[model samples]
Target: DCEFLGIVGRNGSGKSTLLKLLSKIYTPTKGDIEIDGSLVPFIELGVGFNPELTGRENVYLNGAMLGFSNQEMDAMYDDIVKFAELPEFMDQKLKNYSSGMQVRLAFSIAIRARGDILILDEVLAVGDAAFQKKCNDYFASLHGKQTVILVTHSMENVMAYCDRAILIEKGKIIEEGEPAKITEAYLKLFNLNS
Candidate 1:
């Protein structure tokens, strides 16, 4: 299905694979993806960041990686800095930042890119309680406003946030429907087998 939706399941249940397929990071073995425009993927937080580079520099670096020109990134650089809430620390080297700080900056850059579609694969499960809360609030705010696809084992979050969900198992969707019902089915089936 080519719908912007939720992909959910327990570990090793192909949830991440489904996200990769949609992101085209790993193309489907036998299929064609013909999206109308660019689909930016934030599959891994801070994955492309150069540790030696300053956060500000890495902002441009990530923008370039996402195929944006220097001018484009420069235009949105302030917003990115604001969204990440790291105005003063922009000049610091990435390696010197804590893991939580890195995640904050990376997620800020990725989400602010705001491409045609967003495929979030557990990227929000970073930082401490406060940062995680901020991330959750950010995701919550995006509800119904943008086209996004989320994959996480946080059933409560799914139940609270997602409108539709598709349960994946072993590289295929086993169930697709309302979040509450689909999640119940997943847990029930998994419990029976376990």
Candidate 2:
């Protein structure tokens, strides 16, 4: 049941849209999507976070949206803050946080929460280099152990982590195969479309 699948495409190619459909954040207009497992989607990280609220408040808020009870959120609060590396800033307003900080905080919460299938949409593109490495390592560790749907522009991620890959163009899957072939085809799109 565990499959590490990668989706790659240029901007506006429906990569994020595909993730949304899979996560049920968006309903498909013409097709049926049958997901066999529960999934935690990290789409547009920090989408539910309020700029006016403190990071701590946002954590609870975000957690609640993800179906966590207050007690559940309380139990995981410390670990989430620690993982975000923003223990000191938890009490501060989210608006004060940098984009990187916001993303890290969102990512931390998502990682700490429970889910069988993890759907990530460009979540690897943010945070500092070290944090990126941490995420990379986390994804690597998930290989063959968790069902992960990764939608990234990073070909490096596809090559390193994906067992199979698909290339989407104009809201449709144009190619599907091994990571190397999909990546190569994806790169060629730019030259051809340019």
**Top-lDDT candidate index:** 2
For each candidate in turn, the TM-score is: 0.88, 0.92
Cα deviation of 72, candidate 1, in Å: 3.1
lDDT (C-alpha, whole model) for all candidates: 0.81, 0.90
lDDT per residue (tens digit) for residues 30-132 in model 1: 8787766667677887778999999999999998887789999999999889878889999999889887788888988887675767788876687777878
Q: In model 1, where is the ten-residue run with the lowest total lDDT?
A: 1-10
For candidate 1, the per-residue lDDT at 152 reads 81
Q: Write the per-residue lDDT of candidate 2 for residues 21-98, one digit (tens) a residue.
A: 888888999979988878888887888899999999999999998889999999999989988999999999999999
3, model 2: CA deviation in Å? 1.3
Off by over 4 Å in 1: 1-4, 31-37
Model 2 alpha-carbon drift over 4 Å, by segment: none
In TM-score terms, candidate 1 sits at 0.88
Q: What shift in Å separates residue 77 of candidate 2 from its native position after superposition?
A: 1.6
How much lDDT does candidate 2 score? Answer: 0.90
- lDDT score of residue 106 within candidate 2: 94
